[model samples]
Target: MVSRILNATVIGIISGIVLGAVLKVIEEQTTKKVYTLLLNIDFIPILNSIQFGEMGEFLFHLLFSIILSFIYMSWTEKSSPNSALAYFVKASIVTFPTILLYFPLSFLALKEVPAINDIQSIMFWTFGHFMYVIALSVLVYLQQKKPRS
Candidate 1:
């Protein structure tokens, strides 16, 4: 049990950092407006502010990633399934609730981003979330597959 928690925490921190970099690069390379609005819930003023700015957004995701990993790992104790498809299923469990929470929470933390915005923006944002799931699920699956030390 302790092993699982420890492994999960490690994986979560790694996942957070990797996903943060990926998301940042994607946002930078492609349309900044989409991922910026989707991933960041910082109020417009803070987001635009000279201090903390983008770092604030990255840190928020990293912190949540660790917290979410603890929650998700706790649920994966019994009869471990270890397939790619299974990973997707587990990740979906994490992803859906995250999106649901994000929509409402965005308003509280930042301005309410219109969910009914452009189709491309929504699509890319959703893809970014899936990318997050992919990173998490892969990390979890890798840890699970390793021989218990």
Candidate 2:
């Protein structure tokens, strides 16, 4: 049990790092082009700000990923037929309320001061959350699928 938990934690951290890197690359490339196209603007300043201050984001996601992995493992342990698909469905259900709640709260708490009016920004932010959930779910599925030795 201890070993399984430890393995799950390690897998979660690795999954988090991979997901974060992929997101960062996608954001850099896509945001750069999108911003440039929309406003004839460069994303250097935004990227610089993030570079200086992204540790909290990374830690938060890492911890959340670890928790999600544990939850999925627990669910799988219940062992119904089609457990993998059930886990995926359960994950999606769990993610829905988070998606619904976080975006408005994030906008209100963080972006309200600037009064962000860009629909694209809103969409991108929500899309990031969706991708995070998907990544975590995939990690959980992969961990659950590993053969016991």
Candidate 3:
């Protein structure tokens, strides 16, 4: 049990780092910004505003990945190799709570810290969450396909 938890944590952190790097690259290329959720509030500024040096970025990714991993595992407790579609189902299930919780929280946070005083900014941020959901789905699918030894 301890080993499983430890493995899950390590995997989560590593996955988070990878996902964060990819997200960072996407943000840089598209000039999009990312925020961190704080106290059920999105407190961080646009990704571009942050110094987000290499170390800071890595830590951000690592922490998020760890959290995501645990969420994934918990949501898919009964999933197994025999259930090929289980990953997609679990991914969809996971997305619901995130969208419900993060959307309003993010909207309020952004409203409080108005990066751009326009409707487009709100739309873009909301769209970004959709993209994140897709990414999470892909990540969960990939992880499920990994061979266990």
lDDT of each: 0.66, 0.55, 0.53
Q: Cα lDDT for residue 46, model 1? A: 46
Worst 10 residues of 2 by lDDT: 33-42
TM-score head-to-head 1 vs 2, winner? 1
Query: Candidate 3, residues 8-122: lDDT per residue as tens digits?
Result: 5776665555445544554556554433421222245576466665677567546665676667766665555245456656655654554354445556664243244445434
Report lDDT (Cα) of residue 143, candidate 2.
67
Query: Considering TM-score, which of the candidate structures 1 and 3 is the better prediction for this target?
Result: 1
RMSD of model 3, in Å?
Answer: 6.0
TM-score each candidate: 0.73, 0.60, 0.53
For this target, which candidate reaches the highest TM-score against the unseen true structure? 1
Scored by lDDT, model 2 comes in at 0.55
Q: Between prediction 2 and prediction 3, which has the larger TM-score?
A: 2
Give the per-residue Cα lDDT of candidate 1 at 18: 66
Model 2 lDDT tens row, 1-149: 99779866886677557556655664576662221121111133463355323565467667866876676566656753255556667766655664464334434442222124555555554565566566656666776677877
TM-score of 3: 0.53
TM-score leaderboard ranking = 1, 2, 3
